[model samples]
Target: MEKPKILVTGATGSTGAPSVEMLLQRGHPVRALVHKEDVRSTRLKNLGAEIIVGDMQNMDDVRAAWKGVKRGYFCYPLNPDLLDVTVIFAQAAKEAGAEFIVNMSQKQVAATAKSPATIRHFLSEEVFRWSGIPTTHLRPTFFSEWFLYIAHQIKAGKLQMPFPEDARHAPVAGEDLARTIASILAEPGPHINRAYQLFGPELLSYAEIGEVFSQTLNKDIIYEQNSVQSMADSMGLGGSDHFKDHLANVISDDLFGTPDMNDVIEKITGKGPMTLAEFIDKNRTAFTT
Candidate 1:
């Protein structure tokens, strides 16, 4: 029997790249949906994926990508039109009769959250479920990739984040999350209609993250307590109203909430989640630069 080709949306992204690599490694034919033909798309082509250029927002592009694909990974940028993009994807996937879809969502998503992004994510999950498509949702907490937000500070030997020292969340590694996604794509029967909250091995605050950096880099990395305003200023978003509202959400509700930890990753992938130290070690060059 000829196997169906898997379509990977966000093929050039942090998670999508790894997922594409994994599927190709497993000898599965893959159609990579990329927004543009760039170096990243070229790399995926080199890795034996069929690259299709299309925007997620454009229904025609999405339909073209979804054609003749039974399994797919659904991921979109964190933009104001995220929900609309998901709708386009869901409608297209339904039209294509896709067998399985893995949706990339957030662990911090709440029904009552004030952030438009969070609210959109929360509703996006519901839309996929209601679409009656066999779907699995991956709700990952703060990605270890977020360390890049302070990569400048780390390179300067100082760590600065808006969240309080006591505020903590278990940040998952992007590669680990990708592995989980790939595992499900490889065998969708076990994960159908399931939502998994993916997290790393430990819950860490900004202060603890500083300790990890100091130990991993063998440098005196200091965690400086900065107000939200100062943090915004540091990040060159001092006057942005959008960032101010997001910062307010973090301060008032989001950052303080603890995420539920689980062994879902290990259970599915047959490997334990990576640690903060491991994440830093893997991307040591980024922090050092």
Candidate 2:
């Protein structure tokens, strides 16, 4: 029997890359849609993936990429114009007779007003459902790997934050999320028409994360809370007043929520999610320089 053709958008991103790798390892025929023909595109092409060059915002490009594809992994970064692009992808996917769509979505989407990212993904979900394509929304919690973004502060011996040190979050590893996505894409029907809340095993506070960083780096680190106004001043609102306001509201409420999903990771991917300490230990070198 011939394997189904899978198309992965945002194929160079953290989660998308692993998803592509997993699908390939599982012996599936894959095509990667990238915005530009670059070094990354060349590399994926070498990995037995058909590389298609196209911007997600361009319907013509998206339509071309969807040709002969059966399943699609739609994972794009947060952008203000994402909704417009998503609509085009959905329309194109439907016209091309794609069977399933797996979206990389946020867990806190239910609490806040539609940020550009959430709005676009929410619309994509609706489109897929109405178009009769089996859709699975993977709402993974905060990524433990995102700590690398703040590694500079850890190396400087402090974990500065806008919220209290007790602020808690369930942070999952991107690789784990990718594993779950690949499993579902490999066998489409069971996960179709469902939204899975993916999360790590434990709830950890900012102070706890700091401790993990300290242990992994063999140094002392401490979490420091900053006022909302102070955090806004430091992190700039980025010209989106609505996004800024929504962010402030969510952070004030303590954006790090508890884990609600049970062991869906083990059930879906046949493996436990990676722990924070495991992630820290594996990527400790990133904090060194």
Candidate 3:
């Protein structure tokens, strides 16, 4: 039997790249949608994926990429035009007679959320649902990959953030999220019209994260607290722009979020979620080197 070709947008991204690799390893035909033909795209091509280079916002490009592909993984990058992009992808999938779509969204997304990005995601999910398409939504929380952003701070013996050190969040592993996505894309029957809130096995505060890193890396790491305004100014999130709006929303979520640590990953893939300690152990080099 010819495996159904799955179209993966944002193919070179943190989640998309791993999802493509998993699909290929499972003997599924993968069509990777990338923005440019570069080393990353080359890597996907070398790994036996069909590469389609184009912008997601362009309907013609999306329509072209949707050709002959039945199931798709749709993910748009953080931008001001997510609603427009979702509309284009949903309409294209509808016209192409695409069977199932798994949309990547953020956790705690609601129309009332203060962040434009979160609200945009909430609206985007609606776009897919209203299209009358067989769609599944993956709403993953803070990624373990975010550690890389703070790796430098950790290496400097401190973990700095815009929020309080005690603010808690359940950060999901990127691989776990990708695995869940690929599994559903392979067998969309049971997942149709469902939204899964994916989280890690445990929730931890920044101070707790610092302790984990210190214990794992054999170094004294401390949590250095900073005001949200100062952090926002450092990252240029203080301005009234789309990026600032997104960052502010993230800060709000990080400070106030108390997400339930669910077993959705294990329920779906029969494997337990990865812990922060394991993440640190696996990527110790990033912290040290």
Candidate 4:
């Protein structure tokens, strides 16, 4: 019997790219929706994905991508127009008669959230809920990929971040999250309407993580507790005002919270998610000077 065709948005990104690969390996047909025909999109096409270049905010583009997709993954970058694009995607998915959606959400997003960006995240999930489509919402904690982006700093023997020195969260790996997503899409019957908080195998603070980096990279990496504003100012991160505010609020929220490990990744994928040490060692080139 043939499998369902799945559409993955943000298909060139952290988890989306790997999820596309996993789905193809599982014998499920995949359609990758990307913003442009870049090298990343070309790679997915080489991996047997039917790549579609379109904007998530454009209804016509979404409808084109959703034309024959049964299951879909909705993942948008952290930007100001998250809710707006979510509405368009939901409407298009409904029109496409989509069987299920694997929604990409963040941890600690509640309707009563203080941050506008976090509130937008909550409202986006609500849009999918109101669509009445079978949806599996994945709320992952800090992604381990966050470290990779700052590899230049680590390579210089210094690591600076926005979160409190003692603050911590289970930094989930992109591949682990992708595996969970592909597993659910492969068999959507059990995951319908379910929401999961994804996490890595262990919880550790930035300082602890720095120690792991030191041991893995064989260098004494220093962890600096920098203000969120400074980090944002340095990273720029597309120059979005709302995203900077969101980053500040989320970091503040973490300052007052405790961290712990969860088995959601193991529950879904039959193995524990990757550890920080493993992630650092596996991607050592990024951290090596």
The numbered model that scores best in TM-score is 4
Return the clash pairs for model 4, or none: none
| Candidate 2 deviation (Cα RMSD) | 2.6
Q: Per-residue CA lDDT of candidate 3, range 24-141, in tens?
A: 9989999999999999999999999999999898999999999999899998877888999999999999999999999999887876778888889999999998999899998888
lDDT of 1 by residue, 1-289 (tens): 6666899998998899999999898888999999899999999999999999988989999999999988999988666788999999999999999889999987767788787777788899999988999999998877898787668889889988767777778888888998999999999998999988888888877788889999999999978777778777877778866566666675444544655577889999999988999999998898887
Q: Local distance difference test, per candidate?
A: 0.86, 0.78, 0.86, 0.87
Displacement of residue 180 (Cα, Å) in model 3 is 0.2
Per-residue alpha-carbon lDDT of candidate 4 for residues 212-283, written as tens digits (9 for 90 to 100) = 888888889978988666676656664667866776788654423543567878988898888899999889
| Whole-structure CA lDDT of model 4 | 0.87
Q: For each candidate, C-alpha RMSD in Å?
A: 1.9, 2.6, 2.0, 1.5
- Give the C-alpha miss distance for residue 169 in model 3, angstroms: 1.6
- Return the candidate ranking by TM-score, descending: 4, 1, 3, 2
